[model samples]
Target: MTILLALDDTDSLESRGTGRLARAVADAIAKHYPIWGVTRHQLYVHPSIPYTSHNSCAVIHIDADGGEPLNTALSIAEKTMLDDFVEGSDPGLAGATLDQVAPAVIAFGRDAQQMVLTQERARTLAANLGIWLKGLGGTQDGVIGAMAGLGLAATRNDGRFLQKGTIRSLTGPTPAELLLGAGVDEIMTLDGRRVTEGTIILKEGKAAKACPINGRVVLFVDEQDGKLVAVKRN
Candidate 1:
């Protein structure tokens, strides 16, 4: 069973405190389920880009000081997840908006037997509608319990530890799958080795003309014409 803890903009700007509130809610959900993985994405609103993520059983949306649109976006995400459950596939509705159909989406997820939401998701929706989390079987105490037992603390102010969980690095052909938030341009081969760089490398069955003895190898390309301009050895 999995639960998707999704966040939307409903709480007032002064009270929305995402990181703190998210952590608190995550803590509570850990009591009933074990979170397996987390993936983050960027939501493009008219002028703002908010951060969002999907955990084993929850989805999280974090944004800046925006209100109505945030709520609308959250509703869309919830609906998307529910749609996936219904279809039994990767619901290709990640970036779509469905504000008018939010209530129906919530009801669907609630009825799914294999999925559950963290107290945070339930509480945020309830608060927006002047309802109570307890009425939905979601509560702050549950979140606190999950966080404490799982050792999932709120992210710190310093930009050191942005990722959660023990699996910190990636190993495979598509490194992009691991560093979804990192703006990596491309991956290339240097000295018969594969390395990630800011540009793609093109070769004509010949050794690289200029190779660096230290650091990594990267192929720099022309911005306008998309041509391989230089081979940079860093």
Candidate 2:
């Protein structure tokens, strides 16, 4: 079974980034299940929205068999965020079975990318769809982005991975063999050309991140300075 989890607004300006916090949750859950990865979705950014950074949210995909592990994963994520989130920060977590999500919820996510959404609207939709949604602390405004992220994550075109969710981390100029061995679905340039064997992919430390597209883990790149440099996630 595939589980979808979205977390948002778990920090203040000086606190740890939500992407890092989401990575921690994915790491914890991977101890029991196969975590595909966490994806960072950019939400609508405006003065009306009180966001810590980038006005974004993160969604994680995991392979778990039953509701027990899913609940356990949710507990682990909520506890981690509650214990670890910065003071004065509002945090929210949205989770559901991927196969059971409603299409309307995903439409909301698409709208959120371009327009500001309200908490009342998200909660109403979640209520109708019976999706899992909760606010961890503060004013609980994080629920808005958390809900939107869940919808966006269900789509193939919304976000970038925080990590590859493999036991081995890919850093620096990685070879094609390493990427394939680490469970990467495909290695391709930004223009959709596949990387072949014996090719070197120039990645800059942690900045080099991959995005999920069309049900595949895709690392976009471009030719620069005579080397294939990864297009860092924004």
For TM-score, the strongest prediction is 2
Question: Candidate 2 has what TM-score?
Answer: 0.92
Question: Over 4 Å off in model 2, which ranges?
Answer: 198-203
TM-score of each: 0.25, 0.92
| Every candidate's lDDT | 0.29, 0.81
lDDT, residue 89, model 1: 21
Clashing pairs in 2: none
Question: What TM value does model 1 have?
Answer: 0.25
Clashes of each: 13, 0
The ten-residue window of minimal lDDT in model 2 covers 199-208
- Put down candidate 2 lDDT per residue, 24-48, tens digits, no spaces: 8888888888887788998888888
For model 1, what is the error of residue 129's alpha carbon versus the real structure, in angstroms, after optimal superposition?
A: 22
lDDT, candidate 1, 1-234, per-residue tens: 122233322122333233334444444444433433222211212212111231212233232223444444435444433322321122111211223224533443333222433445534544454321221112222221221111111111011121233323322222322332332223334334444434333343322222112211122233336432334231
